[model samples]
Target: MRFVQVAQHADDLKRAAAFYAALFDVEPAALFDPPGLLFFDVGGVRLLLEKGAPSSLLYFEVADLHGTVAALRSRGVKIVQDPQLIYTHDDNTLGPSNSEEWMAFIEDSESNTVGLVSHTLAAGD
Candidate 1:
């Protein structure tokens, strides 16, 4: 089987929608207010923001982790952790070999911690 949707806790659909739209730079794909459900497409994966869902720690891959963090901070988003080099992939298992992985954490509108990640070629590669 393949992945389809990820459910994230959202008490206020509109607020969550706005936050995610700014973060992803995309509008919500669909929203059903009767049952309190909102959706966004993230790299073909359905991100479901529902009132009944539990808080989930989500990680998103970004082109520039540091830049994204800075932009979010400027937008008044709470920064949980500054960008830092997290790992260097020496084998092509979790990520490309010889690539450096950088990550940062930020608090979402729903008070959930979200992670941003970026990968780049090692120095002198």
Candidate 2:
């Protein structure tokens, strides 16, 4: 099975759409005028934007979580959670023992909790 579409709710269609456009670096694939739904193609996955508050968090994979968060911060994106180690591996996953997983979060214009994450095989302090 494959996941084709995921949705997020936003009270302000224009603001949310702008934010997503800036984030994805592309205009929405389709826009519905009446209910004000905007859809963006995210690496083959369809991200549907609708009206209301987001029901859950959306985590976007990033090559550099810290750098991405910093860049987004400079662009006026609200960072709810700073970059930090969210998990660590004891076995050899990325490197030897002590490999870490990092994550950070930002609140979207539509009050959605969006996250950025990175996983590497390097040992962390």
**What are the clash counts of all predictions, listed in order?**
0, 1
Q: Give the alpha-carbon lDDT of every model.
A: 0.94, 0.83
Structure candidate 2, residue pairs in collision: 94-121
Question: Candidate 2 regions off by >4 Å?
Answer: 52-54, 90-99
Candidate 2 lDDT score relative to the true structure: 0.83
Clashing pairs in 1: none
| Top-lDDT structure, candidate number | 1
Tens-digit per-residue lDDT, 1-125, candidate 2? 99899989878778988999988778989988786888899889999888853566888887888888888999999999999987787877653466677889899988789988887665635
TM-scores, all models, native as reference: 0.97, 0.84
Lowest lDDT sum, 10 consecutive residues, model 2, at 91-100
